[model samples]
Target: MKAAVLRAVGAPLTVEEVDLSGPGPNEVLIRVVASGVCHSDLHVMEGVLPYPLPTVLGHEAAGVVEDVGPGVSALRRGAHVVVAVVPSCGRCRLCLRGRPNLCTAIRGRPGVMADGTRRLRLPGGEEVNHFTMISSFAQFAVVHEAAAVPVREDIPLERACLLGCGLLTGWGAAVNRARVAPGSSCVVLGCGGVGLGIVQGCAVRQAEPIVAVDLWPQRLEVAARLGATHTLLAGQEDVPALVRQLTGGGADYVFDAVGSPQTAALALSCLGRGGTAVLVGVGQRDASLSVPITATVLNERAVLGCDYGSAWPQRDIALLADMYAAGRLKLDELVDRTYPLEGVNEALADLKEGRALRPVILPWGDS
Candidate 1:
């Protein structure tokens, strides 16, 4: 099989013919169909988030099951599935507590399988690590059965792939983590792909006066089309004051999808009394947040940290698929462009330049 190889930090990925091993116990082999270029992948490629080198870089993907290993009874060959980055062990403390998103099954091992072994290798027999359980950048991926959530066959893999990462993170933060009440005021910071999903999620909950703030006017425009009642340009507007004005005092929920210290602070500033600030983006590796204790105490404001939208992959991804099937979710609009496997680098470039919202890569397609 051919896979994209990241030899070192800050290196350009090269497509190389590699050897992929069959699935082991509790694992499954999936033929890659559609994968997305995520900011996290860029972070890993740029050395912001440290990981093993000579690895395949991709986590968000959807594909068809080619085969399944022992202990996997829930899935079989020909089943369409979406790959999840947070594959839970199901028996861990977090998983048992209904917080599978925070499962500690692979704390110290982000690059390999649970048993500390890789399933990919080069022609010369050198090991190539997997990124986030399933490296969907390749022609095929071997992942734990739990990581592969079965989706409806009608929804295209290209659209369903977004549920694995960006969209899920933003949408889940609203519906899962914050649980914004209907008619409540909400403000979303950083109108990227995730922020756009947050806006849509707020809309789904019927939250009023959805305020979206961003540096890009184009994204703000997209947010308006999705569900934002108000949009503010970051550098040109007094965002917090405008949010306060739009929401009648402050928003009930403020989501920081940009994940910077600055944006996180802005999220806190946009909240009203008893409001919560949800941190959704992973900005910097060494980023530390400082909050005003006196103000928070006086206003009774709260801050919440979210990972993967606080999602249970099996439940939430399936719900998203159903929503899309019912024409209630905005999956098709999220796709800004598509690329073949060979154009993965160009796709990454587009992501960095903000040229596309969600670029899907077809591993088997030709340009």
Candidate 2:
């Protein structure tokens, strides 16, 4: 198999021929069909998040099952599946509570697979770390069966890949975490792939005056096409003030999809009394945001942290697939472009430069 290896921090990923071991017990070997170039992946590449070197760094992906190891009864060879970044151990307290997104068993270490073994190796036999359990940047991935959410074959793998992370996180943040109610005012901070999904999710819930914020006019325009009733340029306007004025006070629900402390603070500032601020973006591990204690207490404002949109991959992915198939969700519209695996760096550059939205990577050439 060929995989892109990140050997050092702040370095371009090198495409090289790598060897992949067969799945271990309870694992599934998947042939990567498509993966999305996500901001989280860029964070890893830019050293915003710490991961060991020489790692395969992609998590948002969909693939076809090539084989299944022992004890993997839920999936079989030839099944179409989307890989979830976080794996759920059914016995965990969080998983048992129906919050698999916060499964304690898989919250910390992200560089290795379930069994604590590296499945990928360089041609010269050096082990390469796995990123987020599913290294879909490669041509093949060996992941725990729990990470593979089987999807309908009718859904295209390219679009279905978005369900693994960006789309799920954004949409779930609104629908599941914040529970944006109908007739409520909603504001999303950022207009990238995840932000756009939040906008669409608010739309689906019939939220009024959906406001999309971003530094780029193009992204704001795309957000409007998807669901945003209004758009605001980040630098040109006082975002929180404008949102407050537009919503008559402040938005009932504000989502920060940019993941920076600044955006997180802005999201909270854009919330009305009793409104909820949902943080969906992943910033530096040690990043901190300061909040006004008096306002939070007096105004009854709430701040919520969301991981992968607080979604259950098995259920949410299927629901998203159905919604896409039925035309209620706009998966195709979120995809700005596609790239071959060799162009992975270029795709990442585009994403970082805000030149593309949800660029799909075809590990195998687009057929």
**lDDT scores of the candidates, listed in order:** 0.90, 0.90
Error of 1 at 6 (Å): 0.8
Please state the error at residue 124 of candidate 2 in Å.
Answer: 1.4
Model 1, residue 258: what's the lDDT?
88
* Cα lDDT of model 1 by residue, 149-260, tens digit: 9999998999899999999999999999999999999999988779988998999999998999988888888899999999999999999899889888998999999889
lDDT for model 1 comes to: 0.90
lDDT of 1 at 58: 87
Give the residue spans of candidate 2 off by over 4 A: 106-108
**Structure candidate 1, residue pairs in collision:** none
Off by over 4 Å in 1: 106-108
User: What 10-residue stretch in candidate 2 is worst by lDDT?
Assistant: 104-113
Q: What is the C-alpha RMSD of each candidate to the true structure, in Å?
A: 1.3, 1.2
TM-score for each predicted model, relative to the true structure: 0.97, 0.98
